[model samples]
Target: MNSSLSIRSFAEYVEQFTSLLIDYSPKLISALIILFVGLYAIRIINRLVRKIMIKRELDPTLSKFLADSLLWALRLLLFVSFISKLGIETSSFVAILGAAGLAIGLSLQGSLSNFAGGMLIILFKPFRVGDTIEAQGVIGTVLEIQIFVTKLITGNNQTIFVPNGILSNGVIINYSMQGNRRADLVFSLSYDTNIKTAKDIVMQVMQNHPKVLKNPAPTVAVKSLTDSAIILAINPWAKNADFGAMASDVLENCKEAFDAAGIVTQPYVRESSKA
Candidate 1:
């Protein structure tokens, strides 16, 4: 009798297990199907988003970031839905996820700030990639604008990564924004030098330069009289790309002209009266 009773109990346990499986098998299958379909949908959506960003001419870094973020968010929601369909309560799960997200966000305050700044930069567009800019005491051409940082290639070819937070908040001087830029140059001359003669020489040099713009007209004037010298200010306008070349040419040509005219630059003096 004892052996018969043990066999009967084992049979009863197997029946119950079979019943449970029968009840859950369909739900499990449905969850699997949802998971696969959801992942495929997320991928399609990500691709579509990337195409749209490209169409809008959005920054490549920002476009990829936004697309990936959307994909992950959609996948997470699909997972929660799948769990719910499997007869699981998702409110508690969502709450736990929310708590975790909050903790992570709090811990990454600086990163979050930079992300926000990057968003602002994309939206407002104070500067764009390939533009020359000065910010945070560094001047360089923008290489890329990422979610948290911006890459710059300096004139010396050094790569610098500046945090977006600082870049967004700091003053940015975009040298490439305007099509043209003015080169401000000063040449010191002896007080006894003929101001008219020096001005004529500088103006002639600037006007004859191919890179200098002729529309606004170059200006050569006495900027200030100092104890040591008379400061002749030469302002010339040129295309943004030609600014450096134009300035260098102006300086070199001005020096040669002064030498040809037998002009002598005054020595440094601290206490002499202005001419």
Candidate 2:
């Protein structure tokens, strides 16, 4: 009788275990199916988003960032849903996630601002890669536009990382947007020198420059008359890319022409009152 009682008790335990499995198996299977299907759907959605961005000619950095962000966000939602299907309390989970997100956001406020600024820049395109821009007192060509910072290669070959937050808020001068730029130069000559003759020589030098634009015509005129010297303003237009070289050439050529023509330049005197 003792052995029979023990065997019956063991059989009852097995029956109860089988009943429990039968009761929960469908739910477990459904949850797993949903998880797999959600993952596949998220991948498809991410791929579609990437294709759309490509079609729109979006920046590659922005496109990849957006795709990954969307993918993870969708996967997180799917995870929450899958947990709920498994009879777990997703409200508490969502609350925990929200609190965590809030904490992270608070801790990274500056970074978030830069991220937002980057988004704005990518959307509006204030300046693009390879464009020469001046911002935050640094002048350089834009090397890359990232989510947090913009990389610039300065004329001195220094690579500078400027925060996008400042870039978006600050004044950005894009020199590459304009097809041409004006080269303004000031030349001083002694008051005793013939102003008309100096102006003619400077104008001739500019006109002969190969890079100088001829349609707008170069201007050489007396800008101001000082006690020590008369200042001549030389204004010439050149292609944006050629502005620097053209200015240097003009300066060198003008100096040589002035020397050849025996034009006397005024010696720079710090104390003009005493002179």
Candidate 3:
């Protein structure tokens, strides 16, 4: 008698489940169809956006970032629609989603800040790939502009990943923007050295350099008079791409020229010992 009662309960449970399935089957099928259609539409939209970005010649990093963001946003919307189609309450789900999003956002504040910074950088055109910039105490060529960080390669061949948040907020010295750069150099001469003679030598050395700009003309003049020496300022203009090499060449060439001209630099004077 007890086994018969158990069998009857199991059959009743199965009947109830079958009724539920039959009642919801149409909604389930419709939701599935919508999901498939939405996904296909999203793929087409994504492809169209990428093509437009390419046609517009937008930055590759910006294009990829925007594409992925749009794809996920569409997928999220489709998910909400899919569940709502099957008689699920959406308001509570949306609220829970909002709460979860808020929590995630709060936890990833730094990363979000960097992401925003990257967007700002891409929009403002402060610098670009191949630009030589000095920021965050690093001077390097920009290799790639990513969604979170900017890649740079220094003169010493060191690869750096600088966070976009600080880089955008901080002072950025884009050496490549101005097309030209002036190198500020100073040379010391002995008190006995003739100012005019030393100036001529330095000026000639700078003018002879191939990378130095001639139109702006390099300048050599007395900067200051120290107790033991005369300081001469040597300022030269060069193309941005040539600035570093030109400055280095000028310094080296000037030293050799000074030696050939028998120009004496500041003499070392040892301090007297205290009694």
lDDT of each: 0.90, 0.89, 0.91
TM-score of 3: 0.82
Name the regions of candidate 3 deviating beyond 4 angstroms: 1-23, 59-65, 265-275
Q: Write the per-residue lDDT of candidate 3 for residues 1-275, one digit (tens) a residue.
A: 99999999999999999999999999999999999999999999999999999999988777888898899999999999999998899999999999999999999999999998999998887999999999999999999999899999999999999999998999999999988999999888887688888899998898888898997889998999877778899999999888889999998998888889888765534468999
TM-score of each: 0.82, 0.76, 0.82
lDDT of 1: 0.90
Clashes of each: 0, 0, 0
Assess the local accuracy of residue 234 in candidate 2 as a C-alpha lDDT between 0 and 100.
Answer: 94
Q: Using alpha carbons, what is the TM-score of model 1?
A: 0.82
Worst 10 residues of 1 by lDDT: 263-272
Q: Where in model 1 is the C-alpha error above 4 Å?
A: 1-29, 56-66, 85-87, 265-275
Better of 2 and 3 by lDDT: 3
lDDT of 1 at 265: 59
Q: Which structure among the candidates has the greatest lDDT? A: 3
